[model samples]
Target: MSIKQFLDKILKNWPVKVTCFVMAVLIYFFHQISTIDKKTFVVPLEVKSEGAMVLSGGYERHRNVKIIVRARAEQLASVSEKDLRAYVDLSSQSSAGQHNFPVLLDLEERILLMDPLEITASPDSVPLSIEERDVKFVGIRPSVSGIPSHGYTLSKITSDPATVRVEGPRSVVSKITYMPTEEVSVQNATSDVTKKVSVLNRNSLISVGTGTFSVNARIVPQGMVKTFSDIPVSFDNLRDDLAVSGEPVFVDVIVEGELLDIEKLSADSVRGSVDCSFILTPGHYEVPVSVTVPLGLTVNSKSRETLSLDVVLKPEETLPDSSAVNDGEEKDAENTQPQEEMEAVPEDVTDIPQSDAVPEPQIQGV
Candidate 1:
């Protein structure tokens, strides 16, 4: 119809037409209001390292999420966030394998008329698995256990609890053999060694290093003995311009060890020193002396007494013309010095090296 005809028809029935339009509008508005009261929960999602059994405000196992539901307000006042839970319909959809992805929300029966106001249930997922790890065992390595205590010689060392159990990945578990103990260093020791030590390893495959192991050390006995030989005298770095003035320069060979060692060693094991060349001419000289100890023996020396030397230039050799030599006395000072000397190793030291050595074992803690 043309616009004039449509207008004429509406004007002829304006009251009824307006009444119909108003009814239609009222129906649409009521339809919109009917949809408002649908009850649904929106709980906030939360995930935890292990499990999410959180405490409520009053220290209960369940927590609450504030949610806004379109349900009846009267029903809501009677309900709480804790009473309702999010219903993730995984029952129909299969994102989770055989396991159920539990809805973290506390859902109420659909018969309830309440809706959650400000609904927000946080989302969360489960761990891959919930099983505890297994335990495992491994071998042990003990060291620094060889040195002895003061006055005692270590004879032998051994581990008592040698093996430990651990658990973890199969690959890493296979690569490991033994765990090492912390380094033990005991000084001036001459006694049997013993200590409880821990193993060192950090493989998730093994857990037994968390435990303890026993270490045992053995030692031999020998009583007091003197410093076997005199101290060895060494020459410090010197200028070539200054020359030593003697042949057979002296150096003391010092030997000191466990008292028993000094007593058991022999002079043959120790010797005094003399210079390499008789050509020493002017300044200080250092001579070398060597000491020999019986097989399987260790030596230590104190600096109480060191070997000295008496040296002299040839008596017939005239003094040099230079003022450096003749400035004071006009005589050859090179002739004034004496050759080196040292007390000979006592009969005890000369024999110990050859005589039944069986020196003590070491049980050092480092």
Candidate 2:
């Protein structure tokens, strides 16, 4: 038949043409089904704190969910794990506590176009802890560990934002004095270092509003040793009855540090003092001289670390006697004389005669 005649023959019966058109559409869809493929993906799941309460630690699950999906072979090849995600909305919740919510998937236009089937997840629900959110500003401090290099020293450490805003549960917020960052190391470092670090979480109940901070530390090489003379020393806790005096009222302090630190060294910067709380005796003793300086500065005093000071009891004032003054030299001379005079006895002795009749012994024992 001619082309025009073939078309006319096929369209002559309207019911027959309609039936053939339906069969063609069914066969096309059936062929597409035969090429369908199934895939399983581990998609990250997230929870939304849509209500007045906040999620503690901003969702604490450490694992993702497993999802099984069916799509056309060609479309399945193009899909990836990143393309699938699941989340649960907690907008309907009004109270705070633990709750189990069903996981939900957000449908993308591309995903809908693939005509996905059997869209199911292994874990359809997850548990979360919610608490009343509280926010406040707290001071932030950077914590450092480990010592610097042998020849170097750490001069100063500071943070960009001294205070940060933190939001968390009431219990956690109440106990938080300050936010601290992760430990920074200065071991073997000889120069300045600045870095951005995250604030460490004290517990699982609170979150920091300003999550990161800039910390800077200054380190320098050991400088020349400088000695400061005429630094006055003071004593404390002296006994009330004791009077203490140091041999040298002024002391000399020696400090070794960075060049800049050594340049800044002065009599005022170096504090000299002695603690006299231990001095209970009244005598001459050596007391330790304590010298204080700024950070990164070392005081060098080993053998001559002490100062000699004399601690003695205060002398009592003597009052003159009026009666003794009145007595004068006359009373003094009279008192010098003895009450009665006595004759001196000789070394050698002779025996006396009885009743003047017997002769005295000539020799006597000496």
- The C-alpha TM-scores of every prediction are 0.28, 0.49
Per-residue lDDT, model 1, residue 189, is 66
TM-score, predicted candidate 2 vs. hidden true structure: 0.49
Superposed model 2: Cα runs more than 4 Å off: 1-33, 57-62, 151-156, 188-196, 201-206, 210-212, 218-366
Tens-digit per-residue lDDT, 183-206, candidate 2: 788888888878888788766556
- The best candidate in terms of lDDT: 2
* Cα shift from native, residue 351, model 1 (Å): 90
Alpha-carbon error at 13 in model 2, in Å? 25
Candidate 2 residue-wise lDDT at 6 = 88
CA lDDT of 265 in candidate 1? 72
- State the C-alpha lDDT per candidate: 0.50, 0.78
Off by over 4 Å in 1: 1-137, 143-155, 182-185, 209-211, 219-366
